[model samples]
Target: MIRVAVVDDEPVVRTGLRVILGSAQDITVVADCAGVGAVEAVRDGRVDVLLLDIRMPVVDGPAVLRQVAALPRPPAVAMLTTFDAREHVDEALRLGAAGFLMKNTAPEQLIDAVRALAAGRRVLAPEAVGQVIDGYLLSGRDEDAVRRVRALTDRERQVLALVGAGLSNRAIAGRLHLAHGTVKDHVSAVLAKLGGLNRVQAAVVADRANMVGTGPGRR
Candidate 1:
């Protein structure tokens, strides 16, 4: 089972999410709280994922995420946002959010997203994915980044392709039939070769190079 925590300033939103997620047999809403302090409730352990709202009354989702990131075992974050806010979506991704979901997402999609996250995969709403990719591709000065990305080993290239496709480290390990530690080493090497600060940056380079053909939706 996947343990989930919901953090939203609005009581209605929190209750709605709890209701929607409670219907999924594989997921349990372990805790639901308002404001940033709720993040601490799941910090020690037990929570597997966090459904976070971008704008809260006192402490926002990003602020909570900053705290979560500092924890020893941070739960994967899926920012709950409306589709119109493209800037927030991009910032959330850069801030280490695992994925983004529209607030109006269907119940089934929400369930699927939680499952995908549990399986170490990213889940972006289809429209949001297209928007993100469009912006990412159009962002300037790709030639240098592509050149650096080309320096990776065959295996590292494969790993990087998976990263660009939005597969997490564990998912990459499964696809490559490699131990998690080996995959980590390869990812580190790829990051070093490409001079990427994080997996997201490496993914941007990979996407620009068209190295990862299929995206996060594929297995």
Candidate 2:
């Protein structure tokens, strides 16, 4: 089972998440806490993933993420935010958050997101993907970032396009009819190529180039 910790200031939010995740067969809520309780809970346990809120008293999500990063076996974190603020999302990423998700996400989507993060995959709300891209562009499209993207191979580019198109690794593997391990290799290559801080950045680049879809929209 994927061990999880739910950290948010609101008791209702924590309770709601527990209810949603409790229904999933593959997940277990190892702990649930608000504010300082969250930090203490995580420090004392072996959490595989953390569902974290961006705003909390005593200690906020971002601060919690920072502290988690310092842990010997840091769990992957999915930041839960009320808004799509670029600054908060960017800071979370810089602090090593695996992804940023909206708290109002659909029940099924939230469950799927936890599973994704638990399985070592990045999961961001659809709307937040655009913010990461737009923010990068508005920040002057950093030259190094462009160079990193340019380094991808043709096959790696194909894989990345599918990823940016919002296809999962398994889906991409099916599309390519390649082994899942091959797909994983290609994804790692793509990330290296884009110097992408994570899969989200690579997707942002794919979305920016209009290589996939009508473009990023609400998730």
Candidate 3:
């Protein structure tokens, strides 16, 4: 089962997430807490995914994410917020958040996000993806970033583009008509070539370099 922890200052939101996620056969709501309680939850080492509210009373979601990053085995975090401000999105991603989900995200999508994160895939709400793309474009592409991406082989570049589009290895395989294992190899090669810690970090690099068309609204 995929163990999940819900961290939100609002009791109602916490309870609602627990209820929604608990219904999934493959997911279990292991802990539900306010901002402060989130520390213990992360330290417990039982959670596979953490659904963290972006704004909280004393300790905010970003601060909590920073703290979790110091842990030996931090859970994959997905920031939940009503706002899609560029700073919030960028900061959370820099702090190692695996996903950025809107508070009003559909119940099934939220569940799917948790599963995706648990399976080591990055997830982003459509608007969040747009924000990342826009922010990168507005800031102008880094020449070094472009050079780094251009160094990749043709196939690796294809894989990196899909990774930037937030497609998991399996999804990229399906899209590229390659075997799952082959996609995994390409993903590893992409990471090694890009010098990224994970898929999310690599996606950020690709975005900054404007390496791929992230679809319709991205430009």
Candidate 4:
């Protein structure tokens, strides 16, 4: 089962998420707490995925995310918010958040996101992905980013583009007609070449550099 922790200042939001995620057979709500309690919850290391609220009192989501990132084995985090703001999305991704979901997300999608994060895949809501891409474009760092991306070989560039599209290694392998191990190697090479900390960062680089085609969805 995928162990999940929910962190939000609102009791109602925490309870709602617990009930919704608890109903999924593959997911268990292992912990539900407010912002202050989040630090301890993640430190226990039982959580595989953490659903963190962005606007909590005192601590807030980004702060909690930083704490999680510092853990010995941090759980995959998904920032939860009421709306998709560029700053929130950028901050979350920069802090190693594996996904971004609006509080209004459907129950099934929320559950799937938790599962995806647990599986070492990313899960960005369509709108959130768009915002991240838009933020990248508006940052005006495309020339520098593209210069870094161009350091990659052609095959690595192809893998980077698909990674930018949020495709998992297995999916990228299937799409590129390559072995899973080969895809993994290429991804590592891409990350090294782009100086990215993770797949999400590599994806951001590809998007910012306009190395990949951009659109509405994770395709």
Candidate 5:
């Protein structure tokens, strides 16, 4: 089973996530608590994925993330965020948070994201990502971003495009009719070729290159 820990200031949000994640047979909410309780939650069990509230009131999420960073083995962390927390989320990303999940994410999508995170894939919310890099890509269009995208193979480009569209590795695997492992390999290659820290950066390059819908979005 994929062990998960939830750290959010709101009790209701934690309970709701527990219920949603509970429905999935392979996932278990091993620890659920507020930001102050984060360290214990992660230490109490082997957490494969951690869902943290990005803007918690008292014990802020970024502060807690630093605590996790000090751990010998930190779990894959995905921030629970709303659209307005883009800057905070970006900072969290730099600190090694693995992905993002909108607070209003659908139940099935939440489950899928958690699974993807556990499998070592980023679970980014594309809509929020588009907002984060708003005008920045325009300046890099002809420079770094364009040159990086040019180096990808056709298959890797297809994978990068799907990734740009926020599809997970499994989804990309299905879309491209390749095995899941193959898709993971392609995603890793794309990150390396693009000189990206994570899939989200590679995604930014894909968007600037106007490649988001070019591959799998085609009929």
Candidate 6:
């Protein structure tokens, strides 16, 4: 079974998530806790996926994540968000979260996201990612990050943006119309150029650099 922990301040939100995730036979809600208990829940419960809320009254998502990231084996973490908390999400992204999930996401989609995350994959749709990245770019400029990203080649920048969006090699290949193997190569090169940070960390850099690509979802 895939173990999942839900961290939210709202009791109703936690309960609602438990019900929704419970419907999946292969996925289990190991612990439904508040941000205060986030680390303890994951550590004690042997969680495989963590659904974290960034808007808690105390003990924010990124703060909890800092503790979790120090664990020998932290579960895949997807921030529980409502789309308006871009800055908070970006902060978490730099600290290394798997991705973000909309609070109002459909039950089926949420289950799928859990399953995918448990399998060590990202959950955002490539098409939808572009618009969110655009938001990050518009939020403000990170001149230092932009300079770091500017050192990359144009194609590398595209690959970096897709990676920042939490896309896998296959999805990125599809998005860029390149072969899967080639995408893997680009990923390796991108990491190398970014001083050998992991994909999610590199994503944070890409985010600050404002290089995450745009999509049709943008108005």
Model 3's TM-score against the true structure: 0.83
lDDT of 4 by residue, 1-219 (tens): 999999999999999999999899989998999999998997978889999987776888888999899999899998886644565555666788887787888988888788889998777775456666654555555456568876788888888888887777888888888999999999988787666556666777777667566422344
lDDT, candidate 6, 39-146, per-residue tens: 989875389999998778889988999999999889999888765665575567667777677777789989988998998876653333543454445546434555
TM-score for each candidate, following the candidate numbering: 0.67, 0.86, 0.83, 0.83, 0.84, 0.75
Question: For residues 24-113, could you state the per-residue lDDT of candidate 5 as single tens digits?
Answer: 999999989999999888974499999999888888888889889789888999888886665575567668878877888899889988
- Name the regions of candidate 3 deviating beyond 4 angstroms: 133-143, 208-219
Candidate 6 deviant stretches above 4 angstroms: 83-87, 123-141, 164-166, 175-178, 195-219
Note the Cα lDDT for every prediction shown: 0.76, 0.78, 0.79, 0.79, 0.81, 0.77
lDDT of 1 by residue, 1-219 (tens): 999999888889889999999998889999999765676778787899988887676887777887887788888888887644444545565578877777778899889889987776566664345545544455445567689876777888888888877677787888878899998899889888876546656776777778776533354
CA-only RMSD, every prediction: 4.6, 3.4, 3.5, 3.2, 3.1, 4.3
TM-score of 2: 0.86
The weakest ten consecutive residues by lDDT in model 1 span 126-135
Candidate 3, residues 69-122, lDDT tens digits: the string is 899999999988764455455567668888878877889998999999998878
lDDT (C-alpha) at residue 56 in model 2: 74
lDDT of 1 at 182: 95
User: How high is the lDDT of residue 199 in model 6?
Assistant: 66
Q: Which runs of model 4 end up more than 4 angstroms from their true locations?
A: 82-84, 134-143, 214-219
Error of 5 at 61 (Å): 2.1
Task: Give me the overall lDDT of model 2.
Answer: 0.78
Error of 6 at 35 (Å): 1.9
Question: Which parts of model 1 are misplaced by more than 4 Å?
Answer: 130-147, 152-193, 196-203, 206-219
